[model samples]
Target: MNMHSIPGRSDAEGYLFTRRAAWFAYAMTIALMLMDYIDRQVIVSLFPYMKKEWNLSDAQLGSLVSIVSLTVALGALPVALFADRVSRVRSIAAMAAVWSAATLSCMFTRSYGALLAARGMVGLGEAGYGSVGAALIASHFPNRLRGALLAGFFACASVGSVLGVLLGGVIAAKWGWQAAFGVVGIPGLVLAIAYLLVRDYKTVRLTPVLERATESSTNAARHIIKALTRPRTMLWVCIGGAAQLVVVSAVWAWMPSFLNRMHGVAPDQAAKQAALIVLCGALGSVVWGAVADRAGRRRPAGKLYAMALMSVASLGILAYAFGPGAALGGSTQFLIIAAGSFIMTCTVGPVSAIVIDVVHPAVRATGAAVLALFQNLFGLALGPVLAGALSDTFGLQAALTWTPAFALVAAGAFVLAARTYAADMGRAAEAPTETNHLPLGAARA
Candidate 1:
């Protein structure tokens, strides 16, 4: 169906397809997203095992995670831009299959170089998945549910992440680490093929070029630039999203290790504990996303405010959970860490909705890709390496203690985004004119 054909404001009710079809598509998208994270994260739980087997350093271990983010950052834009032009679903499915196969390859690799290359391939496969999948979901659902739906969508990462770590740790410790890769990879491969059975939405690219020239418009270049450079688009969604991720990525990547080395927990035990903390993050995503959606109904700035508060508050909690000066017991620290994780993840949904609220529908995947690029480069790529480097210098504990502070920086960016949010959102609300083609600003994705 032409999902964007409805004449009213961009929202769930405006779905050109039936509610059931939209939801079915959403279910498939989210399930595949789950598989994506499972493949992306399963290696993390096997870190200690691989490190010992290869005599690798902590920094090398960190590279395994960082490499995925790096490749994703590099691949996001081009692939998503391509999907915007051709087909998002097929692109996502194909990418998912590639990553899953790469994940399976890890099970057979004998050397570190081969495994590293495999991880890079997995990252390449994952690069455009988030942006394109999110675009797919956004196209199916309405704008009002954007926050919660995207939150629920993003929360799948948390769930898959938890399973990857938990299942990898348990399976590896019992059966062998190689088995962990296959367990996670197989499901993703199956799901990728299953995704092809879902339907596609027909959305004509909305651009300002003349009707006669629209068929072969060079205006796509200009519109892409405008989409990427919009005020709120540049300042808030991409940058602010990256800022919050610094803490999120660092904590997720490092939390299991922290519990293992510092607290005298076994690898499997640490993975379980870490998984619980991440599970809290998943819960926080839905709760915070729902809160953002409700508050946004009253004031458009509510999502930004919600994000800012979550970042700042989570920072304070993380300090107590990780800092050396604290008098809290180990059990208390775990609980506090879980609380902090839950609050920190609240930003996931709002940042997504905000970008969609501002960018044009024609390039929504590109917008999502831009956000993913910054998020990976700034947050995922930098956060872990920075922590690992700090650990190499001072200690892992010191690095963990300091990493949560990035949330303060993120909170500041959210406040800045709020400043221009109203104006930007107002601009996005004006639907495209059917008679005369208007500028990109008038076309909300």
Candidate 2:
């Protein structure tokens, strides 16, 4: 049965987009997201090639991966602010074009400096994409399905990472590393063109109650600040989410290298093994996101509670897998690592949903950007470099073993965030509703 044909719980609330239109938008946004991560992560599998060619240090190799997240962190807020006020569809299309172009540019760069600059451009283009895409998906879909939908949306990143790793290794082995960029880069350009067909909701007008106050630049800044930061839930969630990604990003970035060094697996085969772990993480994201939503059905804080437990479980499983499990045979160790990978992505969906739940509808994208800013800067940006530096001193195995411990910090942060979740959600409920959305286009089959 077509789920779009049935009325979702929020249908009575009158979502502006038709169910079919909503699904279409969701599909496009998710596809672009998949491409976003593919371009960002395809470099991981190419690390061996780059290292061999340039004779780069481990930290430098990690920096190539880290630079994208760093630029994304620096750029997410301003891009998201612009996206909130303008057209999400147009902004997303522009972003896709920029990143895809950057990805393609990677093929032509001969020096380390040139490649690093190109990678920075990729991050610049992707900076606000996750937040903006989340806002678009949230607005189009009904409330009840938001968690599952958003979870699936973010899960594409893992899938992309999987494909990126697999393709980069295979393509590099067959042709060269440069060809991997060319191969992955083309699809994003095509998808960017295709994305134009997705319908967008009318920009929501600010309510009259605070309209006069926002007329002043100072007051507008204050209003925006309050909207994004007033929620304690946002603070803790941001920290927790970033901390969790430290674990996730490190594992994802280095798993291929780890397998090669530890088990003496070839680059292409190691990437395939690493890709399996990423695929499991992607599956875990969707599964756990749905589980969080189901747990939250009655209690508002249930999502946080569930995530906290999973965070701790992931920490334990991964710590052991990388540390002691390495002593086990290769097959045994890979199975354990994959299990840990599956459990670690539990918070991917709910964190975004929680951020959206606490902020006004008008600043939903910006709210999500705050989370992205944290995740990108402190989580994704730091993870690879931190692990790389560690690997330089101790070894790749030590870096992987120690990195998963950050999940403990994530668990604690989530537990603290839960305390204020109910109250924060209630406050969000009282914010003025956006009734006058400027429709950009009509829905089409």
Candidate 3:
């Protein structure tokens, strides 16, 4: 059934559900997001054990983490482009199965290369989750409440990150690193089944008149390339949000290791601590999204300004985290780091909301895919590797010192991003009538 065909007020009927089915769909999407986070972070929590077991060098270990992100960057655009032509729900379910199985496969690997290969496969699966899921959620929710809903969905990352670290750490400590992989990896099969049970909401299609006039063929490659090359959009994709991912990746991937090496926390303890920080960060994301939505209602740049301020705060916190302060040695350090982590996470919901807001709905998936590609390639792929290499060459503390610099650069990007909000909103407002075609099939139907 075409869900959008239901008769009612557009805003009420489209979203802000009164029906149980609508909420169920929304919850299912969030669950998918949560599982996606678990798959990505399970390896992170097991890093300490893996390091000890494999006798891996810092650079080599960094490469292991980087491989997944590299694969993600490579896969994101293609999967995103493909999603436009196929069913997003089906694509996500397939990806979930692939990655979940890959995660379990990590248990069989005795060599670093084998493990890296497994992680890369996981990355391949995860590549579809972000772009496709974001697009799906945007389509499901009305534009008025999009920011709040996406924030709720994105907050699952924090939940998944924390749970992955906590659960993986405990499992690894009790059983083995392989057991950790098995536990986190096996759940995807169940989630995949659950995903199949959930209904797929039909997207609102773009007008056909515009589609025929604008393009001779619905070539996915052409669409992806065009979306990626949009000047203002590309600028934000590469420099703004993706740059922040770099610093975030470096910290989230290695912070547990850092605590163990420098502060002398055991593997499990460090993981738990990291999990706590992630939880706080998750809360911050939800709160920030709500506030930004409210503020954006009054001013167009509200979300951008919130992101900018958070970026600056995150920079200061990271600098403190790496500095030679007495505070780093105590339990208080966890609280401080948690606060910083929360602030960093606060940017996620708003950044996502703004990016989606700026682009036309038809190319939303493509825009998100390009953004994910930059975020993975530059931010996730390089961030941890660069930090780990620096730590190896210098010291852990010194490596962390570089985080603030990246954070500052991210903050600057947000400042630039702030300027484009009005223009983006304007473009989006005019897109339906002016562009004449739905970029995605949903708009045309």
Candidate 4:
């Protein structure tokens, strides 16, 4: 079916999908996204084993986690720029293959350097997927549904995290760490094929006025740059989402270890427990997205407010997870932590939806890219490394205690984000008629 074709619909409504096509798109996108999370989290679950095998320090372990984020940041803008010029579908499919192969290569790595190289390759592949995938979804789904669909896409992260850790932990326990890498990495190849099987939609042309204005050499570039450099975009990109990522990266990257150390659980058990946490978090993504979308319909700024509440709830949960004199222990601690993780993750769906809502369609990819850049650069790179350092300096428990502080910061950022919603919507409504027809490369202008 021509998924983008909807009779008598305006560009504002974008594509109209058959129910089957929409579900297919959602499923395929979710699967692709799930693999992305699984591959990333697999390494995290294997950290304890990797450390034991390599005789690595906490610092080195932190490097292993941060390296991927560092590489992703390096590649994000370039790949996003490339996506604008090329086929986003093909780019995403190719990325799926590239990262899957890189992940599998980890099974053969003997040293930290080799492992890091493989992880970096994974980052390169993921950068393309992260920026391009979101753009494609934004284009395919109607504006009204974008937040919910994106939320659904991001929800897969929870599933991937759960599977990555639980399965990796199990495989590592029974066979070896290499087996864990192989098991987690190999499935993505199949997923790549599934991605290829999905049909690609043609690029939607922007409105004529945008096309004409963008035809001017200076106009296109200026517009794109202006879009990229917008204060609203930058604020959320750098401070809001990035701060949350810091919290997320640190928690996901190290939570398994925290579980093991605090509760004296085996690696396999810890992995299973962590998986449960991720599963709950994944569910939160869907629930929050729906809530945000519905709420935003009534109150335009409701999405940000939802995020703020999630952040606050996350802080409380983190405290409960680490708080002193609590009666909870063993599986109870795991259950509480899992619940908390889910509540925190709930914010992700709404936050991303709101970001897309505020941007022009032509520059959507750039908006996504800028957000990805900040999220990885500050959120992924700094969060885990800083947490590790703090762990070394104070104690693991103490370091973990500080992790939730970022959530509080994230809450403030979301509140600030709310301030821009009405203004952004107003700008979008008043956007030039020709804004949509501009070439992808001219989007920033």
Candidate 5:
């Protein structure tokens, strides 16, 4: 049952066209990503309980989220490069198993230190999964569908985040917070093992005659360094994505507490309402991604332009949602924040698509890993910690009010990404640097 062996699903360029196995991998990868975030985020729901029991400070609470992102940032490049050099399928499965097992271990923690250790393990497991998974999905679909497909893939974060908060709240309330970790952790383990059965594409190889025409001095380290850095577009895209994700990560990490502390909402109700806001983000990821796909039809840079526009729009909505408008009724505030949530996530797909667009397929996983490294380090790793510190000083409301300003920085980076995007794409296509040999470990045994 080698699904990749089946014919009629790919073009001459080796990009997969319409195919059953392609869609199946899409489903499985996206599902695994969903479970990944669920396990990663479910800890947020237990923050209140943990704080009560542990008597932790806001910094310690924020550290729980930051440490995971920090570890993921540290590990992303190495793990992604290893996956590119090894078997992506196996790598992905191993990552899933590690994270799931670590998450399950969270249930046994007797002190804050134990939970911190376990969370770092979860980060190690989750680090390279995104880039490897994105690379696999990109290789299986044509460029035309790249934006929508990747965006849809990333949209699972919203779903996973929402569900994690919702489920964690409900289960923790009825049973206990430990039960919340168990419920989210077990399904990921199942999905990890099941992923081994999925078929993978073989790397395209050169015939003997064609091998002579290819360059002999191809260096992987050189290629990765040159590709990820020189292209002004790639650098800006990575920085911009990190800048924008700060807002998204902070909101996800702290909104439940915002609801509880500011509005007097119960834990279940707070998580439930926060989930609704995040659900809007899920909707935005898919909708904006599809829109970017359609808009990118004739223009190579259309997707990046769309990202910049949407990001600016999001900044305005969020600024309003958290500011003077705070005095509005709950219903109006919810709608405003929901709108911001949708707009805030518009960059997920287009940004990912842009990264793959500017790099050769051979280096795509590493390219993605590099971009994710910045995103996690600057955005996910820092956002919550910054928010928590601000909350400690200025109050949570003011801390959130200022988070939207970072979106301007994100939008500016997107504009910079657009300026050199088309040029970068053209240069990468014309360069023969990556054609010397197929990527290491890309062949099936």
Candidate 6:
């Protein structure tokens, strides 16, 4: 049987593919996700080298990191919209190829301007992969497993970040910073080709409620707007998620530099130490995501509350770790920062699931893209640049200390989201889409 032609099984189980194919798709998507972050974050560990070679300012170095997220944010909606209307697998493969190629180009750029533009291209390539991949995973697997699986999927980001920081520093120490980009860029190209083999659900047709008899330009705009704004839950979640990521992105981007400057650690050793904290974050995303999933089983709104509590905890932990704790000792501060790292990523998985849960199935990717927009633009893009500017003014430690307070804003948004989550979910159920009631394909693996 042709794998692509196998009809999805339609039964209570509601799985779109056989267990093996679904898991295979899941694994491939996550692997690409790992490569995504590895390429995006490896630059962090190379900042020291870049600064020395180019005599770059902190703001300029931070811009190198922020530009990717900025492009990702700007392009996410359109790319996701295209994926929703076209083929997820093809779109993802194309995106991976673009980003991987962009990463490769970075090694050849001798000037700062060329490298910055290349980094922006990488962001454009990565723009919609996360939301599109999440949509693919949600379609392939049963709903019961969505939370844990998505958590694990996103956790790979932190894992990749750890490796990126670790490898970039070590590779740069031995070879050169430019070589670090070349080394990390290869695996993604191979993965992009392999991803063409992954299964994808057929595109969900837009319902009459969304696309009336006349699918005109006006209606299309209306459709897209409604898809993004129908459930207020998404708005709050987007804000909350972006707020939280401000903390994550800032620390991840600058921790190695912070350790090097504050503790007298060498650049390579600082990256190795910082990678440990990112590893803790990866573990935390999975653990807290499962916890949120279990809590939701009892009370659908419990997930939001759990996220809120975590945001608060992260606020307190991180603020102290970068603030007063710095005066204690390098060893003491590292321990506190690692603990904060674990708690701060609690919402990464649940936030995606939350956005997915409340949106119409047909526009799932687009809806999730909205969340990505806020996260990449306001949170990830803002964090590094803002911190860098502060570093340029006050100092790196002061910048890090102040950035964690954004988690407080995140906490409030989550609490507000809980107020309307149950109702928004009910509204989403009324949305007629292929994935909710019909299978897209069967497994041929």
Best by lDDT: 6
Worst 10 residues of 2 by lDDT: 436-445
Angstrom error of the Cα, residue 86, model 6: value is: 4.5
- lDDT of candidate model 1 versus the reference: 0.74
Clashing pairs in 2: 202-437, 202-438, 202-439
Best by TM-score: 6
Writing each residue's lDDT as its tens digit, candidate 2 over 51-81 gives: 7888887788889889999998877655655
| TM-score, structure 1 vs. true | 0.82
Question: How much RMSD separates candidate 1 from the native structure?
Answer: 5.0
lDDT comparing candidate 3 with the true structure: 0.69
Give per-residue CA lDDT, model 3, range 1-445, as digits (tens): 1223322333455663444555666777788777777877877777788878888777777777788889877776556545555677787789888888998899899998898899889888877576566556666566666668766776677788888878877888899878888888887878876777655554335355543423433454465566545537446635767677777777787877877887888888888887777677678777777776777787777667767777788878877866744355666666677777777765655665676677775566445555666677887788878887887888767877676577677777877776777877677756763433323322110
Q: What is the Cα-based TM-score of model 3?
A: 0.82
Q: In model 6, where do residues sit more than 4 Å from their true spots?
A: 1-28, 84-87, 134-152, 194-221, 227-230, 293-303, 356-365, 422-445
Alpha-carbon RMSD of each model: 5.0, 5.6, 4.7, 5.1, 5.4, 5.0
After superposition, candidate 4 runs with Cα above 4 Å error: 1-30, 87-90, 131-154, 190-223, 228-238, 290-306, 325-328, 437-445
**Candidate 6 C-alpha error for residue 115, in Å:** 1.2
Candidate 1 lDDT trough over 10 residues, lowest sum: 436-445
Model 4: ten consecutive residues of lowest lDDT: 436-445
Clashes of 4: 14
Q: Across residues 1-445, which tens digit of lDDT does each residue of candidate 5 receive?
A: 0112322358665556546767878998999998888887887777778777888776677778888899888776566556754577899999999999999999988888898899999999988777778767877776677768976876677678888888888888888888888888899999999988766655344455334322232343455676467678888998888888898888878888887877778887888888888888878877998887887789877877788788888888887877876899667877888899988988876777788788765556456656777788999888888888888888888888888788888888987888898999887777675343333322110
C-alpha TM-score for every candidate: 0.82, 0.82, 0.82, 0.80, 0.81, 0.83
User: What's the CA error at residue 119 for candidate 5, in Å?
Assistant: 1.0
Q: Which residue pairs in candidate 6 have backbone atoms (N, alpha carbon, C) closer than 3 angstroms, thus clashing?
A: none
Clashes found in each candidate (C-alpha, N, C closer than 3 A): 4, 3, 9, 14, 0, 0
State the C-alpha lDDT per candidate. Answer: 0.74, 0.81, 0.69, 0.70, 0.77, 0.82
